[model samples]
Target: MKKFVIFSVVFLSLILAPILFTILSPVILFSKDNVIREFEKNFNTRLPKSTVSEKIYDDYGGFHNDGMKLYKFVFTAEGKKSFVSYIQKQKSWKNLPLSQAYQALIYGGEVKDFSGNITGFGGFAKEVGLPKISKGFWKAIGDRSVVTARFIDYENLDTKTLINLKSFDFYLAIYDTEKGVLYMLKVNT
Candidate 1:
């Protein structure tokens, strides 16, 4: 009986530990202030005295119990609109104006290896929905002259059960206000 109890305890620990760790890791690692600080540190070039314009929690989808907090920043640079965000669950930092740095992490294929099963584009597309993500979606997103980006949670696609939508992978959108161009970044996560 003692041996059986010990084995069960060990098995439970092995299985549940990671699950628990994944869920709780974000709370332990990052706080709202930490995210704010990281954003300031990364985007300080444009935003010398980064001020938090807004802070709000948004549900990207129904994937995880904890949602993401979006941070908006108003930079001091002329003709430059920018912001920064952090995904608590993913523990990632993203600075805006959607530069190459942001692309590298979101769609550059590096995020997949870093976060494992947690993907940037996949989470984005799922949350934004398919109708809003058509071919010309990029143009529309860019027309706004205001660029907002965030790493919020969203639903995961069940590839095994569906085949027609198999081509669908991940979603990312960036709009250049001055250039009047919208850029879409997609990757297989």
Candidate 2:
């Protein structure tokens, strides 16, 4: 009886140790500012010097089992606008266009507009002021378009990091004067 109890205890401890670590580990250590640093390092883009605005909202389990805490930052650079976020619960980061973030900032209240195709896939388009122009107009400009960087977890939800990590997907719709062209850029890092 004593041997059986000892064996059970040891087996249970071994199984539960990793689970406990996963649950207790911080999902995200980066904040809105940290996201800017990462973006600069990876993309070679510079953020505006002016103070960027940020708001935190709950994801309601949209991105993960424990749900996500989204931080939205708004700023303008080179006469263009942009936004970025650090998804705490999802352990990922995102950069959005200024217009989309503004729209959500204004009418959407605190709720975020997530893409149906993927849980954490969505971003803002550059603000063009006019209705029709802002919808997808950035794609029309040779220089502007909606861009998204996504990180997905492919393993058991209980695990701290997803297994079988996939390549990152960056999407952009470039608009020439006559028509719009969609471009998908896949990169592995």
Candidate 3:
């Protein structure tokens, strides 16, 4: 019986090895390049070919959460049309841009690895045992602009299943009478 059980365990391990590797492969090969590629793939769909009006400045780190990195971007752009369209698509995003900064953390569309989750990044948090996140902010750069935000959440897709999503990603949209630009941030916890 002992020998039979040992054989069974080894057989099960052999059978499951590839499956486990498939699931873990993303992490072993994790890189910012992958995250950026994945992000652009998803983002371009929402704001296709929105051109940048000014130079973009990016800041990244593991400061906010241990074992998790966060990315923050500050820039100017001419994506008003696309940004407004996205705001319209979001349920929690407010209609008035100057009145208030709106926010939500739902699972959003169809994530590559997570199947067809509809709720956006916030819902993903619920699935992985964290409080839902709300990441929007009032205008810091320009008082006239309303700084809106979305949690990209996909920044850490490689580790999405293993880590918390709420602390890992965010996108902020800031707009005023002159122009608009989206601030994209990614993090992990």
Q: Model 1: per-residue lDDT, tens digit, 1-189?
A: 999999999999999999999999888766555644544343232233444333433443444322333333333443133322112122232223333223333333223333244333333323422122112112011111112212222122222212223222333333333332223333332
Order the candidate numbers by TM-score, best to worst. 3, 1, 2
Better of 2 and 3 by lDDT: 3
Which regions of candidate 3 are displaced past 4 Å? 1-37, 40-45, 53-78, 92-179
> Residue 70 error for model 1, in Å?
6.1
Question: lDDT for model 1, on a 0 to 1 scale?
Answer: 0.35
Q: What does candidate 3 score on TM? A: 0.28
Per-residue CA lDDT of model 3 for 22-118, tens digit only, reads 9999876654445444444534434435333221333334453323122222222445555556655655343223221122332323233345433
Any residue pairs clashing in model 1, and if so which? 142-175
Q: Which consecutive 10 residues in model 2 have the weakest lDDT in total?
A: 137-146
- The candidate with the higher lDDT, 1 or 3, is 3
Off by over 4 Å in 2: 1-28, 53-71, 76-189
Across residues 50-149, which tens digit of lDDT does each residue of candidate 2 receive?
5352433433333222222223334444213332221212222222232332333212323222332222222222121111222222211111111322
Residue 6 miss distance in model 2 (angstroms): 44
Stretches of model 1 off by over 4 angstroms after superposition: 26-30, 43-189
